[model samples]
Target: MLGKLFLLSLVCFFSLNFLSTINAETNLIADEIQSLKVTNKDPRMINFSVSLTEDHNYTSARLFYFLPNPSLNKSATRGDLNGIQSKFNNFYVDFDTNKGITGSRFIPTGVTFEYYWEFTDVNKNNYKTEMQQYLFLDGQYEWKLLTADNIFFYYYGNYNKNIQNCFLESVSVVKDGSDLLAIKVSYPINIIYYLSPSDSRYAKPTRSIVMDSMTVLGGVKYTSNVVHSYDQDCGVVKHEVTHILNEIAGHGTLLKLPFWVDEGFATYMMNKSDYYDNIIEKMINKNTVIRLSSMQGKPGTPEKVNLYYAQSYATTKYMIEQYGLEKYRSFFKILKEDFVIDEALQTVYGHDQDSLYLEWRQHKGLPIIKLVKIEQSSIPIPVATITPLNFPSKTTVNQQEVENNFSKQNNSNELAVSNFEIFINNYIFIIVGAILLLIMIKISIFLWKK
Candidate 1:
């Protein structure tokens, strides 16, 4: 009887052990992520899925990702799939740009986003898929590509080499300006050309703002279709591009730049023939030029608008020529770092805006006049015509000042005439020579590359 009882106990113990082993094996049967597929549902979102085979007991799972937008983020982006749905035996998540899932603000187009999925099973097995990449775009418009080395110029509509070349030419000037300002650009220079005013995505806003052109994210958007003529495109093309470069050098922040500094800096970079130079000269002769200090914000009165732009340009030119670019660059960086214009000026030039204005005016040979301190947002509009103020009238133009102005203008006119005469005299030969020179240079470059 005792032996039989012992055998029964052994059988019971073995049965219990076997049951425990089966329970452990059942618990070990957790889901393994077989595959991951990512897709863009919209310009801003990434829809993804994970395939699981065998045991599908994933009690908890999530995705870890980041935009390798030229580079990966220092921290990985993660999303919990606890409440997210799974379909067709696959789990998914949408890393949204608008929703700040792909880091903070909206992820700009033409940038690649990278991500990966991380999932956990009931058995504590954490599965991670490989990183994936995606480019965000609206996919609604056709595009063209124009390249000059590293500069990428994208345009819509028919290809015009002249228009593209204008942009390429502007690119060199822009870089030169950046160098002058002691600014740096690490990324590739990317620009977009909008052939027509209505063709741009920001067309309505562009029109509403009364601007001939605008730029965003280093892309130049202009109105109407034409290869920019030399003198004509300065107001639109180089002006907008200068603004873009300033934004770029400052890392896309121009909040601290004063209204004149911003606009004037653009004009300075272009350094083309001024649109209002004649008008400005006339105003100066009439002693009607607006005080440089009055150019706060973008004043909109028709009469003073050109005057404001002129002062801005003159002030900027003064800074560039008289103050030296090194000091201007330091000031540019200070403003870029978000210091107020007055503080930046004081730090860099040892003076405030008023003092700078006074100096700039003196440099331009304008008579000293007391200027009212107008609130930035409350700039008084000049009525119908700009009235001359606080100066000797044309009849009172002292002989010395007139002689000085006349001598300067006469010398400039003579120099311009002499250069033009030479050009006209050798016109046909000059063109032929230029063409041959360009061809030779191109051949040399081709051979060097080979």
Candidate 2:
């Protein structure tokens, strides 16, 4: 009976030892799966592993991958105390017999992100990790990726490929009296230009125009597309930089000034000689001259648009010439303070709106027409009258009276007739005397000759 009891106890000891070995093996597998390794191929796929442990709080976890083309993808797996989440079916045992899993995510070409691993074991332990990578187009032109402290600036395309060379040629970042500003040629991005599909009207309308040249936007960078034609004259980087300064000085408000003023300021900073000439020519040609009032908002019509941009350039030039740079700088401050166009102008220039308009008009050689009224009820008229009288009753008149009347009438008629007769007689006498003188002279001459 003692031998039987000993054999039973030994069997129990062996069973307990076998169970402890299995538990130790499971714990060793869990402890070995401490970290995950991630690898990215050219097209972007993610592979990683998660260690399962007890005492973690979360039962499942997710991993996110960012693509370059504005999209993201995620993979999720369940957590296990001794086994990985069942969702990761491809999971297998590593060389050391730890849990291993691999999966892929299709993200946009340029997508980027920071990732944190979120999971809770039976013991409530959490984990997070950050990763970085960039997706580039597959072509002959390879881009040098740049990232500084989580901020990234991607350079692509021909110009972008030679960014360092271009930067050497055109860019300058200067520190001036506690201020920093970078002057650089900003190449255009075709994608950004086409990004605002809804605002196509404001974008380049024709392939021809798009081919002509790229334009600067938001005063921050220059933009161009592959189809742009006028590439050589894109040296307006300084002009845009000045606008950035002006915008900042104005507290990031354009103050609803006319487009002319806005552009004029930019052009003025670019150097106004050429712009001034153009504006003067336009003014002389009676092209649209933007009024301050008219330039208070976005230019709507084609005529106004031309005027807005041209006049903006012109007026900004005028301001520089008349007000000086210091005053021009102060004008922005005034605008920021008042936020009223007319009031700002008056405060800065010491002139009212109408007066300013008159000045601008005069400068442009435009005539101002004013309405006037006249009154016409103050003239006097001259008067004249004639009266008819009946002949006096002759029957009762005495003969002497009748004779006197007839004699007076006859005397008046005879006076008139005598002046006529005298004139005729004088005329006849003068002719007769002249004829007699001629006859006597002829007779005397003839007698002498004989």
Highest lDDT scorer:
1
lDDT by residue for model 1 over 123-199, one digit each (tens)?
A: 65555555567543334446566665435555555666666666667667667776777765444444445554334
Model 1 has an lDDT value of 0.48
* lDDT at 309, model 1: 61
Q: Give all TM-scores, in the order shown.
A: 0.52, 0.41
Model 2 per-residue lDDT tens digits across residues 1-450: 565555555555555544443332122233534555543332223344555444334455544332111101121111111224544311211111111111111122222333334443444334433443423221222444443221133334444433443232122211120032222223222111111222222222221232112222211222111111112222233343333343334422223333344455545554436645664576657745545555444443222333454566666666667767666666667654525555567777886445665676677677773323222122222211000000112211000000001001111121212334444642664555555555655555555555
The local distance difference test score of each candidate is 0.48, 0.36
Clashes of each: 1, 32
List candidate 2 stretches off by more than 4 Å: 1-141, 144-232, 252-260, 272-276, 352-354, 369-450
Question: For model 1, where is the 10-residue window of minimal lDDT?
Answer: 398-407
Candidate 2's displacement at residue 408, Å, is: 99
Determine the C-alpha RMSD for candidate 1 after optimal superposition of all C-alphas: 24.5
